[model samples]
Target chain A: DTAVSQTPKYLVTQMGNDKSIKCEQNLGHDTMYWYKQDSKKFLKIMFSYNNKELIINETVPNRFSPKSPDKAHLNLHINSLELGDSAVYFCASSKTGWSSEKLFFGSGTQLSVL
Target chain B: AQSVTQLDSHVSVSEGTPVLLRCNYSSSYSPSLFWYVQHPNKGLQLLLKYTSAATLVKGINGFEAEFKKSETSFHLTKPSAHMSDAAEYFCVVSVGTGTASKLTFGTGTRLQVTL
Candidate 1:
């Protein structure tokens, strides 16, 4: 079974379009995270949720919103996406919210805004 | 504050040759360091980690890293490079110890191995 899975491996949309990326993990982990990799291949943390509660929210714009309906799933919703939003979004999970735990990542979703 | 720096943005080596990827980190507290490898279109995979345990940490795929507090460096090294080892490697540092703590990832280093 895939430990972490993200849908829509590739996304191409026009400017001002809204899109949603879904992520699910079957590792029975309590903490989940969303990371964005820019054109320079710099990965930055966007948001994190533990047990359906928001724990970490970086300086990402309001256009990027994350929702965790349950502990096993964390979804990202982008509103009025801009060209700058073109990058790879990754979903990751750990056993707990502990920083020391190793994160299991999913095959990322490549988002391209035209 | 915590941060990580990958010395090289790209490294080229021949198969069966020694491979080295340099990394430096800074943190206020005893930091947890990690090396993650990402293949094209794939997720990051854990190579090795240093958490104040043994300074020399060995990981999968014949990779290993040594943490040096004096220099604040945790460099990944391998005795022999394989073409399959070509990927992007990232150095990561955890600032704090709790669930709320954030991870700082270094600019990745792309490794290219030639036959």
Candidate 2:
């Protein structure tokens, strides 16, 4: 069984379009995170939530927003997606309270903005 | 703040040869270092991690890393390179104060294994 899963493994959209990517983790972890991998393969954390509460929100554009309805699910919504938004989005989860806890990542969603 | 630098953006190795991927890190506090590998069209997988424990940490698939505090380096090494070992490797550092912490990832090194 997949520990962490994300939907729409491949997404092709146009500029100014809106899209949402759903993620779920069954590892019973309390902390969930969203990371972005650019064309250069540089990974960066965009947001983090612990127990469904927002904890770390990086300097991402306001167009991108993350919502965690419950501790098990964290979804990302991008409004008016731009060309620069083309990248892979990875969802991960780890045990809470410790920062060094190892993360279990999903296969990732590849978003291509045309 | 914490950051990691992967010295080589790409490294090539021949089959049966040893592998080395260099990494350097800087953190305000004692850091938790990690090496993660990603195959094509796959998510990043944790190869090994160091959390103020043993300097040498072993990971899955015959991968290991040494955490050197004096040099602020956590370099990943393997005894031999296999064709399956070709992938992108990321060096990560995490610094925490109390209950809050963050992870910083390196630019990643793409390892190429040739026969």
Against the native complex, each candidate's DockQ, computed on alpha carbons, is 0.84, 0.70
> What are the models' TM-scores?
0.99, 0.98
**Clashes (candidate 2):** 0
- Worst lDDT 10-window in candidate 1 chain A: A94-103
Q: In angstroms, give how far residue B104 of model 1 lies from its true place.
A: 0.5
Candidate 2 residue spans exceeding 4 A from truth: none
lDDT of 1 by residue, A22-100 (tens): 9999999999999999999999999999999999999999999999999999999999999999999999999887877
Off by over 4 Å in 1: none
- Over A45-105, each residue of candidate 2 has an lDDT whose tens digit, in order, gives 9998999989889999999999999999999999999999999999998889376789899
User: Highest lDDT: which candidate?
Assistant: 1
Q: How many steric overlaps does candidate 1 have?
A: 1
